[model samples]
Target chain A: MLAKNKKSLIIFIILSLIGAAIYLFTLSDSFMYQRDIGKITHVSEGSSQRTEDEFKNVDHQHEQKITMIMLNGKQKGKKIHTHNSWSNSGAFDQKFHSGQQVFVDLQKQNGRTTAEISDYKRDTYLLMLGWVVISLLILTMEFKGLKTLFSVVLNFVVFLLFIELDVKLNLTNFFWLFVLSAFIFTALSLLIVIGWNKQCAVTFASIVIGTTGALMIGVLVLNYTGNDLHYEALDFATQSPKQLFLSATVIGLLGAVMDAATDIVSTVFEIKRSHPQIDQKQLFGSGIEVGRAILGPLINVLLLIFFAETFAMGVLFFRTGNSIGYTFEWTMSLGIVQSLISGIGITLVIPAASAFAAWAFRKEGQVENN
Target chain B: MKTISILTVILAFLMVLVGGKQGFSAFFSVLINFLLLFLNIMLISSGFPPLWTSLFSGICILAITIYMGNSDEKSSNVAFLATLAVMVVMLLLIVPLDHLVQVKGFANEQSEEIEAFNLLVGVDFEKIAISTTILSTLGAIAEAAIAIASGLNEVIEQDPQITPLKLRKSGQNIGSQIMGMTFNTLFFGMFGGDLALFILLNKLHNSFGYYLNSKIFVSECMLVLYSAIAVILVIIVTTWLMSRKVRPQRSA
Candidate 1:
């Protein structure tokens, strides 16, 4: 077993290195086409003379001066200077740093070379790091870790596949896609990690009941709330907007909430296994206690994970003196509502997951008695 | 039935009354934390770099974690200290990655949304986009911190004799239990909102390789990693913190 395991480890590392190489190669090529190398000669804070009405309501607008290093060819080694507007936007923030190397878009007008800071190559490299870490984790964990890591890789692939299908095929039926992704991701995640077994089956069943049932509740609540509370402040896509936002909310909550539900259910079942004499009421109470313990932290989990990504926007609002209500309405409100719904889903799943586990194992016990 | 219902109501009322105060404080922590994110974005919009924005965000997360941790004063202070230490460690790990990754803008998909809203309301779309991404992960970071701190506190309480090594092992064991589900939570939580995007991206025959490489996809995935790493860091640090405090207290 040890020898076989070692062999598998070698295989995993080889495969990971290949993936890393491919990822790195693609990254180098993508950014090489549009390079904007520059250095920040001066950094200063400047306010927009333009009202909110000016500049197309960009998420963040920053005035920064950049001394261009080299754009494309001949004078590439030479440092040409220019001033450019940088935003809190992800790409520009990377390019327009002080006294740092940058690659910007160069425009030639009347023999003077000018560069506008564009895409940041750093993002590609950061992503490479994320993948590399994941690969290393899989290689290290060997079996269980590899399984979990594979589940992550699998979900990413499924998500990519699903995204392309929706965009290219232009599937108007958004609801089905939501359901299918939820089912497939949840099942695959559980199957790949936990494997096929009665316990795994129970966990799977609980996840379905817990996640789906909670989702139904969430959908009902959203409908009841009239969707007015849904933060339209988020720059949701307009062309196929409503459907897209709905899908995003559903998919975001599905994994975390479902995972929480399964964990709680299986945990209670494990407790029962060790203490078989523990009765149904005791089992039920244990489930509730577990749920209670996790409830606050779990909500925080979703709230922080979902909202952290958007912190840049929230900070912009407060700094710009946008009213708290105004900021909430557009920026943080939708996330709040989403987190709340997931919270409710998670809270309800406690009972649902536990109840299903209780029923399954009890039935199994009866069969054993017979 | 009436008795059970009444008892249930009373229990909830107490839980809220007890947990409610914590809840309110948590709410404020969240609110202040949100404000900090908005501030970072505005600062970034006004020409401060994302590195600064991320630093400010880190301080705010630390403050909020401390505030939320200190709510109970007596008991929770320990949790708070542990949580704060964990958060600091996480910040050390996560802040560098933000720099290294240099994720600079929102996906093009979001640009249209920003532009449309920009036309209507006159808000700077770029600032809005940056703030949104940063804000999205803050809640998760705080939650993970609390989990690691609180979980470590519980472990130490159960086994006061837990040596430093044992405590670290215990924390990791418990964290493994928590992470078994928590990692999944981070994973699905990320793509959860954009289900349609997944369908669209897939239908277009966007390969796994391509999506893995896409800016937006990578950003979301990294955030998940950041959250997971933050959670792990919290576990390690809190274990250390708890051992320091617990060891002294026991000796005293």
Candidate 2:
């Protein structure tokens, strides 16, 4: 126990120190950027301006008096005062305040220095949130939580590499590339969670099988029926909308599919371990039972996630007087489509999970019988 | 439109075909959930406080998801309470973190799509951000809570005389696996959902430091982290509650 305490204390101190270092790094990292960065040390409201949008509603807008100290560039440590307008909705304009670091556009006229806030220097806060999460994981889970965090970070690296690869390849055959990525993601995540065991292999095989099975059916149906997907409402996606959506669908299915497959496999294995004499038939039956229980929660999880993604835009569409159908068409149609595909994956994974799990245990059961 | 209808039908049929009644209920729960989210959006747009509206919606989702997905009264109840506790903890964590992170409203990437629409929606973008954070993580928290509670319930049922130590170990065992799987789910969900945006950022040649600080990237990262944090908290809360409920306390 003393040794365990010392180990975690060391880990805890290291994580905290890392967090502090990142926080300071974000403050100093501004020098590499061409744009001048500043933190608003004082802010005062200037005025409120009312304007009309395309919807013809009177919008309230305001401005602030900002006194900022430049964090980097030739004007480092120099104080600049400027103000910018903001709207209540902040749809396009932004609201800035004291202690918030921002990217600034600096101007010097007649030896007078002035700056305008361009963007927020938010890396510090992001790192803060990341550290909070890692700290909690460490405090609660100790070394195992560290492993989980490491695995997640590893998956993130792999994902970034996948993205980089897709980009370096210039988006050719993107969907197939993502399908390959799905395999890697599933295998890596399962290997980390379950380690290299019979159970891990079974879970991985079932996830791949289930995901691909669903994709084939989904793709075939989309092709046979002709694509009716709307690409107009896509945000900042300058690629082939269909390809983006398809890739998104494939990756989305990975998480939920892994979730369902793991649950089914773990439950099946647990039942087998606790009851050695349990036949493969009963074990498979029990796996299906576990699948049924998780069915609703699984779909609900996907729906909530997808809806939240599009929820803000959907609301803005409605607030602007767009009908529900149009809003649904514009903001939510693709998300729903993605969810349906994932739903199919979740649905198919159940049988794949039970079948693979029971089969993986069959030889073990036969040996026991002998 | 035609594709959505056909696919919906096929999904419904398959869900029923595999999950049977559970699938049917799952189908309803999903339908109700969509409607609830729709209502949430509507209320916030109509000038309801975004934070309050989303809180109400999160509570409803938690209740409906727990009761509908679970048939056992005890496990569902315990899960509900544990999930609510986690939600409160999440809300506390989110409000301050959101303020510091400053990732509210439409992102810079969204400027083109939303520029011409409107500016005066009479809503708090910051509060909407908070609302979104809360509601998004509700599913994972509730799901983990139900899994742990029900799993522990079964363990106790199997051996009614099990000590608190054994029950605690089992809960940890169950919680740890679920935690790992849930992390995978949230991480992939974030990656898959944001792949398009990442590609966009890469094309823009936004440096890694710039992307890390951007509203789009930070917001997505925070969403995943929030869900993950909530799920981990759920495991702890559910495990502790289960052990306590199952164990009889002696006077100290």
Candidate 3:
């Protein structure tokens, strides 16, 4: 058994390295479409830096003569040339170098084929990184990892379907649209991952109550406050940011909340299973203890992810001499709101789960007596 | 603003009402984490390099999450060490990958909003992106570390005679259980963060292929995958360290 474990570990390591190399370098060869893929062969030197008026900062803009060989399109295998310019900011533009695979629009002008860089061909890199992650998950957890991968993919599909249905059907009342989406996502993910069992049932119920309650309370507070929630921060959102933010809160909070519930419920149920005669009070107490233990780490998880996404923007705001309060209002407010709502959901789910476990076990105890 | 104030009040009230002393501590820790995040942003905006700021705050946040979450000295110490190791590994990986991927700076999606702002604040957006990725993985790492360390310690106390190898096995069991939920949390967090954007993307009728190649989608997926990998790293580190801890005790 020890030898087998060591052997599998070796195999996993070897496969990971080889897979990384193959996926990183050779993925371009596997695509079927012949439209707009090119491999950069040479890049000419860029010009020197120049200062900018805005922000009184140094900005550099230079155009490099990039030469590439087209891997697809009518000009397949033909050499092409284009000028790629970039700057210190590189916000909307980027510098390209040799060995980069980019999608290009082919132009035939004056008996010469010049290509316009459209976007980077990034699917290969994603595939490589994704391969590493999926392999690690499977290596660590085996069958369960496969199940997890399946559940996640299914959830992604459902999410895509939700997007399609909402847009195609032109569904309004985003409150209900997202509320219903939250429910469907929760039920489907839990069912596929954990299956329909007694423990799952308890987790499902607690999550439902916790999510809906959080949603309603958030909406209630918004209504009472006349709905001022820094919606302008969610720029480019076509829908109501209020509904978007609230929906994002529930769905965002659901996973961590579900995790907390499962941990507590499973602990309480474990106690009850081991000691069938244990009273509801003792079991309920255990659940709360478990819940409390999970709170800090779980809350941090939500806080850090949400905060990181906005940190750069907030910093930009601060650098521009925006007041802290003003910066917070514009850059960090929506994320903070999301985190606050999710934090509330996570905290509330615990006691609700603990109480449910105590009740479920007591009911089972009575059923056994009957 | 009113919405946030009300939500903050509601959150404070619910937290205090839930776990009582522990709930208050959890709430306090969250506040500290946020304050640190703000300080981190301020320091970077003032020309403190983002990479160093992130490393400093990352360790501080990891310590807060583990020590405050578990509250048991020995187990949390082990957790902190394990989380630190995983974080260092993640940092090394992220630096190179961030350069290779080039998903830094404001994405095209944010172009309209950022048109008026000056990006030449003398800060490298590439380094800032790395910092953000580093910060994003802390919670997951710290959470994974604490979960495994505490669970393994519990097993050791329960079975004082358990061998190091056996303890390692037990750690794997516990880590796998925690991982199921951790992966879900990370994945759904990604989905939830963009559910609205997804609706808009669909409305624009962008193809799946387009979404796949888009910088925003790739970076978002990369974040989720990186977090997952960090969790896996923490599990291994915590388990190995914990097994050694058990080994010393078993001989004595």
DockQ values per model: 0.25, 0.64, 0.60
The deviation in Å at residue A2 for candidate 2 is 5.9
B1-252: candidate 3 lDDT, tens digit per residue: 888878888887898788788778778888899999999998988878889888998888988887776666888888899888888889888999888888887777777878888765656788888989999988988877776676565556545888998777666655665777787788777678887777767777766667667888888889998998899888878888888787777678
* Every model's TM-score on chain B: 0.69, 0.92, 0.92
Interface RMSD of each: 7.3, 1.7, 2.1
* Candidate 1 wrongly placed segments (more than 4 Å): A1-118, A135-142, A225-240, A273-277, A315-322, A360-370, B1-82, B104-174, B194-218, B235-252
Better of 1 and 3 by lDDT: 3
- List the candidates ranked by lDDT, beginning with the highest: 2, 3, 1
* Highest TM-score scorer: 2
lDDT of 3 by residue, A1-370 (tens): 9997998889798877878686856556525544488899999986756756555555676679999988876777888888887777565667888999888988778987667998887777677778888888778777777777787788788778877776777656765776677777778767765667776788889988777677678778878888466775785577777667766777788888877777676656555643577788877887787777778888899889888988768867876778989998888888888888888888889889999989897655632210
Q: For each candidate, what TM-score against the reference?
A: 0.69, 0.93, 0.92
Better of 2 and 3 by DockQ: 2
TM-score of chain B of 2: 0.92
For candidate 1, the TM-score is 0.69
State residue B32's C-alpha deviation in candidate 3, in Å: 1.3
In model 3, what are the clashing residue pairs, if there are any?
none
> CAPRI verdict on model 1?
acceptable
User: In model 3, which runs have C-alpha deviations exceeding 4 angstroms?
Assistant: A6-26, A30-35, A109-112, A271-279, A363-370, B151-170, B247-252
